[model samples]
Target chain A: MSEVRFGILGCANIARKVARAIALAPNATLYAIASRSIQKAEKFAAENSLPASVRVYGSYDEVVEDSGVDAVYLPLPTSLHVRWAVTAASKKKHVLVEKPAALDVAELDRILEACESNGVQFMDGAMWLHHPRTAHMEHLLSDSNSNGIGTVHFIHSTSTMPTTQEFLENNIRVKPELDALGALGDLAWYCIGASLWAKGYKLPTTVTALPDTTRNAGGVTLSISASLQWDQPNKTVANIHCSFLSHTSMDLAICGSNGSINLKDFIIPYKETSAKFDFTFGAKFVDLHIGWNVRPEEVHVDNKLPQEALMVQEFARLVASIKDCGSQPSRNWPEISRKTQLVVDAVKKSLDLGCKPVVL
Target chain B: MSEVRFGILGCANIARKVARAIALAPNATLYAIASRSIQKAEKFAAENSLPASVRVYGSYDEVVEDSGVDAVYLPLPTSLHVRWAVTAASKKKHVLVEKPAALDVAELDRILEACESNGVQFMDGAMWLHHPRTAHMEHLLSDSNSNGIGTVHFIHSTSTMPTTQEFLENNIRVKPELDALGALGDLAWYCIGASLWAKGYKLPTTVTALPDTTRNAGGVTLSISASLQWDQPNKTVANIHCSFLSHTSMDLAICGSNGSINLKDFIIPYKETSAKFDFTFGAKFVDLHIGWNVRPEEVHVDNKLPQEALMVQEFARLVASIKDCGSQPSRNWPEISRKTQLVVDAVKKSLDLGCKPVVL
Candidate 1:
């Protein structure tokens, strides 16, 4: 109980990153790792340079049932998340699952329910939210003083990563059975999360999928664009586009009444050591419509640890509070995850119905 | 003729800028000015430092019919463009009309037809297109080498300018009968033009207005967002949003299969002396998804003349080609202007029909 012992399920590529994060987190230990094949688990451990005392298992159930494992990091594919996450939570292990937590809200609800019933901490692996840069951006957006960016009127976020032909044809993400939401679930989740995060997690009144959506043969979306709208008073609209068919481009811009903020590398900063964003206040063209009177101010945030490690450390702190101090699990992380999942579900539904607006 | 003699009509606010451009254009001479009242025209001429030889007229017809004037710059409201532009063209005066050229494509066709019959040069006053930075951007986008950004898959452009309460309530743009298209005609025209310009002026297959649209009491759109789609071989999607309710923000981002480009000041550069854009080729997250493998390269394009002056100079050069060299009028400008207006009309139709997709 002195340290948060973490067990990772699956040997997915993303799991390798999370495993490194768990090892680097000051309050966490990489206690166990499990793959379908014990040899594969051993090979992963050898390749990642895990400590000699780390346990290797052939089945995910063994990792969950191990009494020494205080928490589970589930980096399984979308189709496998529900089964493993629910199982880990039911076994009284805190759950930290990769994004697109489940195929849909219904499946994600079951995982949340299990965690609630078992009194275990639950957090989605949206690492960017834990970055110091994200906190700085939130401050810029929420500041109400003279220099602050006023009420946000619009937000646009995009996350795109082109895949190789071989991967597109064979990757689990493009297969409906493996990841039914395809690019919408894998990439759009980040865009949707960003839109929500900018608005302080306020759910939009409506969600509409743009007609430019493309889907693979298995009816899994390969690329999608959507707009989220808030009614009356605030009168805000946000647009998000995600695709596996374009080059890697992760950008987010928030425009307020008094100013705007732009981030070129929102999902992942251009560098781990430092991140930068630009903020412009009272931008106006000079007399005679020649040029702007003021240019955007560039702001930078420095971080010593990678965002994933920060995410793991933050999750471990919550688990420690629950395990050592006998405190209740933090509801903030789970609530934000649920809201993001709900918006993702709405976008999928709107796309399914031929780009119709889904009232949220 | 020693120079292309230019006449200014309506004495509108934008006319002041074009008047200075006319004076700066070496091949053009500001010969006359006209307004409904001769006093306003006289005031405009004096305020803009017009030469003593510049004559002031009370009626627009007087300026167009003056034997000394060889070209006319029409900077009137949307509803008045068709009247003044057609009149000027019919008088055999080469025409340069302000944006939202005639409120709709059908009206613009009449103005274009008048120029065709008169055998006079025709151009829409989209001044940014004349900026040296624009040609630089076009070069980067069309380059197909290993270091070049690849084929574009999507584009997003926005032009939003917040107006004061008094202006919103009393400005001619907010009046239904004057600038009937409101923000869509004034601001969204820039967004649509940027999209069309990025695609080499090829029109989209369909245009759909996003549901997040607002209209004022006078039945004029105050804010709007729309998506333009191209089908088949070169699948592309572009989104454009324009509003009079948000702070000044003009942005354009083009995402290609192998690279991408971003510009914060597309409509008007932050500075007239030099403008810059960022281009990234093969941008991808580095190991552990901690940072980008290649950051965007900042490219700056320097301009000795302001964009508006360059626009006037280009128009005068084309006018001189017909007058001094007996060359045919350049159809490129009018053609691009027509395509932009067509897309604007489609967006208006889609918004009118409750956000339905309108075929181009």
Candidate 2:
């Protein structure tokens, strides 16, 4: 289990953040950087003080075909998510693409076929799932005896990239196509993944999108909602909500037979910042004792072991597994890509016919 | 100044309550009883203590044609709602129909035309608007300064007969021809009307229904949701939620910028129910002092009057108004019926296409 040299694809803000964590990660090395501009890539590699043995590549494909690097991280635009990821996977290189992975399903299928046949790994980097509190929360929602939650109910989650007039000038996520994908690919995918993964259901049979088709801000839904059946227990139903128009602290809640499991915010890394878990159960007649019923559980931090750093370590380990064992759990590209594409297809179909049930 | 002699259409439970209220009304008098079965009408008239001077009619048309009866109250089955109401209106009598004025939009239009041409006042028995508390709650939402409700975000008003296994009955509101108007008509209509009237918005450009369909005794999702824009002081959007399957609080909230005004159980007569209007502007940040910059206020209420009595009084007053002026505010049958039909059509369309946006 020696370190697998990791080469960054593009110098995205998220890439920089991840690469910074990779530097801190044990058994991981930032081997090289590759960009469309060779000068920029070399500068990025030099600034990071990459090892003398590590070599920067001129083209994206060169990095994928590099003999030294074991994995390539693709933080490319959503539209090009599949193109490069599939190219890298087909070259027998393990790949980690950004959320959305592909704009639509066709690209996703190509990536799935390429990765499976080439004996390489392919996974979308949905960082929210890596957040430590997510698993503990999933357990609380899943346990029937806990009575902390009943039949799965409504789920709504929102995240905001807070900025002022000064920052808006430099912000690229606001550009229209990016805005559409940002709203869907950025915040929505997390909710989609969490809603499906935690509640144990697939993409909704029905969906809709009210993309802000207004001038200067096209292809973005200021707000979109769909009524859905999540196979609610006791013959009930569920709805998964996503929006990026406004920031809401209205976390996720599972209303159940006896009580409810209310999460503070499921996306953000609990160990990276201050976080707490809340659980409420009992009859509806009883008033919600804000923080009373919730057992005050501060996400315990190992002073010496950084959890986010550990997540990167785990990702590196996953990369090594693909190089050593031909494939890994993370490389189950067909399954993950299929689920991700199903959600994207549902949203797009909703936009076309107003909103309709689109089976995955 | 004299009482308008009113004829009871049938011996239904709702009709009984209404008839008793009419008997106690200062300007209205319950003078006769009518039923398809004359014997049943006589027994109903006697048990309800009808005046000895009043006559009993064997047929509904006979009751409509009787000069002795100044007005008719129709509380028949869903299919017969429009037929009987229109017949009585055509006979030059003021008509008050039960909860749902018509089973379908076309029927509502025919009923409205019949009433208008004959100069007969017609109204649906939606008395919740006349409640003082409901009116006051609406006023509070409109005020964002002292009241602190910023932007009215969403109002989820659910009144489901969840435990009542009455879906076994053949309800016209649940009919397929009604276009998924089951929940929209049966329950969500109140939420829709209350929100629409409160916000004073005439048109909703788009509507989408999520897997919107009809249900039977299994408690269909008359859970309808519509997002309408309120171009008030600030650009505000509202979600009026209504459902039948799940038990929801009988309340509405003015979810605003600074705080929220949750009208506690609007179904209870505002005069008799104890309710507290609270403002929680920015409760998310602990050290933020108040939720918003403004001082928060809490007004507690105690209902001293019988709750149902107010709607009864409003109906009686409207009855007297039509008797004097040939119409009342609630007697704008053309507008009500048109709006009802448009919404019903939209619901059906939304359901057919998985709640796509229906342009107004």
In terms of DockQ, which candidate is strongest?
1
Best by TM-score: 1
TM score of chain A per candidate: 0.98, 0.81
Q: What's the TM-score of each model vs. the native? A: 0.98, 0.62
List per-candidate RMSD values in Å.
1.3, 8.6
- Candidate 1, superposed: residue stretches over 4 Å from native: A143-146, B143-146
lDDT of each residue in A20-103, candidate 2, tens digit only: 666778878877678888887777667766667666766777788777777778877776667787778777776777777776
Global local distance difference test of model 2: 0.57
Give the DockQ-based CAPRI class for model 2.
Answer: incorrect
